[model samples]
Target: MIEKTRGIFLHAVKYSETSLIASIYTEHYGRQSFIINGVHGKNSTVRAAVFQPLYLLDLEIYYKAGREIHRIKNARITYPYSTIPFDIRKSTQVLFLAEVLYKCLREEETNIELFDFLYHSLTLLDLTEAGISNFHIWFLFKLTRFLGFSPSREDAERCNFFDLQTARFVSHEPLHSQFTDKHLTVLFTRLFTIDSSSIENLDYTQHERRLVLEKLLEFYHIHLGNLGEFKSLEVLKEVLK
Candidate 1:
């Protein structure tokens, strides 16, 4: 049966000379892969272009009770971005974050809170000004809450360290440390009161932001299994530099 739902295009692959396969996180079905056919034809090629990173889409998709990959019946853009495609910095950040979501999200079960968080976050990226360089850092931290691994800031004044491997705030550095005091301080400060509303202006330098993000990724790798290095890390670092 055909089911209609909203989805966010996460990534796409060139399946053949005339077709493509896309991975989308749907509002109802969670993560799904779909094959979009006849996309290479000139007129329709533009239609297929809507399946880009962070594109919001309304879709009529064929669903099965237990099958993995589904077929898309119809799809169109829900909202075309105003500047994400044109701004080089925004484009780079979108590409990198898209890859991170592609790697980190792997659920076939629908989650309303997670879906809402990501949809809002992506829109914020498109609408925000240039100084929002530290989005990647906040994105990772916010995601940890949904993943059931958010660190407790119960005693921020006394918790001088963060035990990355154990995913908790510590009074002192552990024997096997993944982050230094400076790194922990930055993260702790952010964790206490950070949100999109209060983060419009950036006080931190680009270099400082990148360093914090890299350290956070290392912390994630120490905990999350099978997380290889983010492929776009070097490109993102270069762009920031």
Candidate 2:
């Protein structure tokens, strides 16, 4: 049976001379892998271009439970990006975030809310101009809420440190190195209060932005032990610099 769903393209690798294995996160299902054939052919309906990082897609798939990889009957870009592919800053962030999502979003079941959050966020990333530097930092922090490890705001105003291991604001410095100092703790806590409407208002220098992102990734690594190092991290940092 074939089912239609919206999807976000995450990553893909060449499987053969003309075929590719792509990982996409679907709205109705979770993360799934599909073999796309004849992508290199002139008449291929689903071109390889549509599989670009974090591209929103409309898909018709042959889905079956217990299958390691499903089949895509049809796939096309849902919303063609206007700026991200053209702008290095925006494109680099998309590449880095796409890799992060591919690594951390391992759920094999439906999560409607999380799916919507991702879809809208990517759309916003392509459209928004102001505060582009802060977008990835905001996105990483917002992602924690859905991953079940959003930092605790308890005593946020009174805390001098953010304990990465515990995912909470601490009144004193943590014993371990996986924590934030008072300055970063204050910045991290502010993320919890920000929403899409106010995202443009949030500002940070390049250095400050990089520091927050590193701390955020550290927080994620502490919770998601297998996240590993990101190959795109250096490129993103270089582009943003």
Candidate 3:
């Protein structure tokens, strides 16, 4: 049977001379893999341009439970990005965030709320002008809420240490090394209150931004199993600096 859904492209790799295997996260089915055939052929209906990372798509697919891979019957771009593909900084951010999503999200069941969050957030990133530098920070923090380990702020007022391993604040420094010092904890408190639309208000310096990004990755590592080092991190850091 064929079903229609909205999806976001995550990653793709060449499977044959004219075919590609693509991973897409969909609104009704979560993460799915599909083989797009004839992408390099002269008469291909589905162009390779529609499969870029984080691109929103409208799709008609053949889906079945227990199948290893599904086939796309039809696909079209739902929203064309105005600047994310053209601007170096925003496109780099898109790549980094796409890598993070590919690593951390692994569910087949539909999560409408999470899907909505991602769709709107990516749209916002494409539209925003002045706050692109801080967009990823807000995305990382907001994504935690969906992944079931958002940091608790109940102890924020008096706490001076952020325990990454435990996902909360502590009075004294953590005995283990998986924590931020008092200074970073203060910044973390401020970061938690910021949404994507208001990310500019955080106003972190380059040193501070790097520290926050490191801490955010640490927080993910502690909570998620087997999330290895990000290959895009080096490139993203170079681009940002």
Candidate 4:
């Protein structure tokens, strides 16, 4: 049977001389891998354009209960990007965030809310211009809420430090190295109150943003232990610099 669903392209790799393997996060089926054939053949009809990172696609696919890889019957872009592909800054951000999502989102079960959040957030990134530099930092914090390890804010008023390992605000610096100072704790509180309507207000210098990003990655490392050093991170840092 064929199923129609919405999906976001995560990554693709050359599988053979004439084919590619793609990982996509589908709204209905969760994370799935598919083989896209004839991508390298000159006369093939399947355009490679649909496989770009974070591309929104409408797909008709064949799925099975225990299969490691599936097949797609049809696919096309659902929302055309205005400038992500041509703009270096936007494209770099997309690539970095897509890599993060690829590493973190591995569920084989449906999560409509999570899917909706990602779809809207990516769309907003493509459309926003005022706070592009701070987009990824904002996205990183928002993503944690859905990942089930959002930082604790209840102690913010009384505490001046953020314990990364414990995911909560602390009155004193943690004994371990995995902690943030009071300044970052204050910024974390401000970030917690932001959403799409207010994301543009976030302003930070490159150095300050880099510090926050490093700390956020540390938080992720503590919670999601398998996330190795992200390959796109250094490139993103340099690009933003």
Candidate 5:
């Protein structure tokens, strides 16, 4: 049967000489794979850009439950980003979000809230002119709610350490060193409250942000199984710096 949905294109790969395989996260369904044929043909610019990573789209999808892969019948840009691609910082930020989502989000369970949060956040990033250096920090933290492990403020403030194995704060370090008080403060004190406009004021050194982000991803790997490598991290770090 056919259904309509608004989706965020997470990743796309060249499947054949002219076709592409795209992983799109839709509000009605979840993470869905689609095959688009004839993308390399002349004047395919319109279809090409619509499938770009993290692009917001309105789609009519041909879905069949229990099928390994589905197809998209009609897709159009629900919202065209004004500056996410052109602005280098915003472009890198989009890549960062895409990479993280590609790895961490797995469940196909219906989640309208998570979809809305992601969609709104992306739109917000494009519209808001500044305060994005700390965007991923906020992004990861917000995602915890959908993952069923959102850290509590009371525990976050009281604990001396972040226990990555347990995905919460602890009074003392666990068997392995997962997180420190410094990074916890950054996550709680700054990322929770600050927006793009306020990101400039809460600025830490680029080195500090990188270290904190690296540790955060480590925490994620520890808790969320072996989501081994992030190839985009190195480039994103270089670009942000």
Candidate 6:
């Protein structure tokens, strides 16, 4: 049966001379893989260009439970980005975030709230001009809420240390090394209150930004053991710098 849905293009690899296997996260079905046949052909309906990282798409798909892959009957870019592909800073961040989402978002069920959050966030990324440098840091922190481990802020005002393993603030430093020191904790906790509307006002020096990102990734790694090193990390850091 053909079903209509909105999707976010995550990653893809060439499966044949003229075909590609693409992973897309959909509004109704979560993450899914689709094979686009003859996408390299001149008359292909679904152009390969639409599969770019984090591109928002409208899709008509043949979905079946227990199948490893689904067929895209039709696909179109829902919102063509005006700036991300053209700007190196924005492009790098999109690539990095796409890679992270590819690894972290594994649920095979509908999450309307999560889907809306991503769709709007990417749209914002393409539109926003200020605070571009700190976008990824803010995104990573916000993602934790959907992943079920958003850090606890009940003690944020009174605590000086943030225990990554526990996902909360500690009055004293944690015994293990998976914790942020007082100074970094202050920077890390500030992300808890920051929203997309206020992201433009977020100002972080390069050093502070890098440290906070490292801590956020570390926190993710501690919770999601399968999320190893990111290949796009160095590139994103270089681009942002």
lDDT per residue, candidate 5, 1-241, as tens digits? 9999999999988989988888888898888888877777785533776877799999987899877678777789999999998988889888877988988777766799999999988988888765577677777777877877766555666667766666666777778766666555545545556653565554656877777687667767776788878888888898888
- Residue runs of model 3 more than 4 Å from their true location after superposition: none
Model 1 residue 42 distance off true place after TM-score fit, in angstroms? 4.2
TM-score of 4: 0.96
Decoy 3 TM-score against native: 0.97
User: How would the candidate models be sorted by lDDT, starting from the highest?
Assistant: 6, 2, 3, 4, 1, 5
Q: How would you encode candidate 6's per-residue C-alpha lDDT over 1-241 as one tens digit per residue?
A: 8999999999999999999999999999999999999899998888898999999999999999889999888899999999999999999999999999999999999999999999999999999999988999999898899999989888998999999999989999778998999899889878877899989767889899999999899888889885877999999988888
The lDDT for every candidate, in the order shown, is 0.78, 0.91, 0.91, 0.89, 0.77, 0.92
In model 2, which regions exceed 4 Å deviation? none
- Tell me the TM-score of each prediction against the true structure: 0.92, 0.97, 0.97, 0.96, 0.90, 0.98
| Predicted structure with the largest lDDT when compared to the true one | 6
Clashing pairs in 4: none
- Enumerate clash totals for all models, in the order shown: 0, 0, 0, 0, 1, 0
Q: What RMSD value applies to candidate 3?
A: 0.9
Which residue runs does candidate 5 get wrong by more than 4 Å? 42-46, 181-189, 195-202
Residues 167-205, model 1: lDDT tens digits: 666777789757547554655456458788766544557
True lDDT of residue 84, candidate 6: 98
Estimate, for each residue in 1-241, the C-alpha lDDT of model 4 and write its tens digit. Answer: 7899999999999999988899999999899999888877897656687899999999988888689999887889999999889878889989999999999998988999999999999899889888888899999998998898998888887788999988989898889989889888777777877789887788878988898998999999889886987889888998898
What alpha-carbon RMSD in Å does predicted model 1 have with respect to the real structure?
Answer: 1.9
lDDT of 1: 0.78
Q: Which ten contiguous residues of candidate 4 have the minimum total lDDT?
A: 39-48
State in Å the error of residue 189, model 4: 1.8
Candidate with the greatest TM-score versus the true structure? 6
Query: lDDT by residue for model 2 over 1-241, one digit each (tens)?
Result: 8999999999999999999999999999999999999989898887888999999999999999889898898899999999999999999999999999999999989999999999999999888999888899999989999999998889898889888999888888878888999888777878877888788877977888888999999888889885888999999989887
TM-score of 5: 0.90
